[model samples]
Target: MAEVRPAFDEAARTHPPLREASSARQDAHPRQIRDDDLAYGLERVLDGLAARLEA
Candidate 1:
């Protein structure tokens, strides 16, 4: 059986421009998961749970 490398490697080899475009997009919009954002989400979930429990 042939060795199967990662799909990403195959894609990178097949289409170099696609890799460059993806890298550019990542650089443009980096992941910014701030603590405040997580806290806000947790607060919303807790509020929802409290409402459900009270209902």
Candidate 2:
């Protein structure tokens, strides 16, 4: 919306640095995603489909 951009910009400028918002602790494990996680994810397609779909 035309009214949203300036409001977002104002809040963004006032927001804290990103690191302060997230992890400050040591991790025992690293994050990961399997290969099939996206090859067949929230939305998938048929090679011969006539239309697209959304979740």
Index of the highest-lDDT prediction = 1
Off by over 4 Å in 2: 16-55
Overall local distance difference test of candidate 1: 0.62
Residue 14 displacement (Å), model 1? 33
In terms of lDDT, the poorest run of 10 residues in model 1 is: 25-34
TM-score of 1: 0.41
Task: Give per-model CA RMSD.
Answer: 9.8, 12.7
Query: lDDT per residue, candidate 2, 1-55, as tens digits?
Result: 3465456456656565633332221121223233435555534555325254432
lDDT agreement of model 2 with the native:
0.41
| Clash count in backbone of candidate 1 | 0
lDDT by residue for model 1 (1-55), tens: 0233256556677688977755554423233435545788999999999999999
Provide TM-scores for the models: 0.41, 0.24
**At residue 52, what lDDT does model 2 achieve?**
40
C-alpha local distance difference test of each model:
0.62, 0.41
Worst 10-residue lDDT window for candidate 2 reads: 21-30
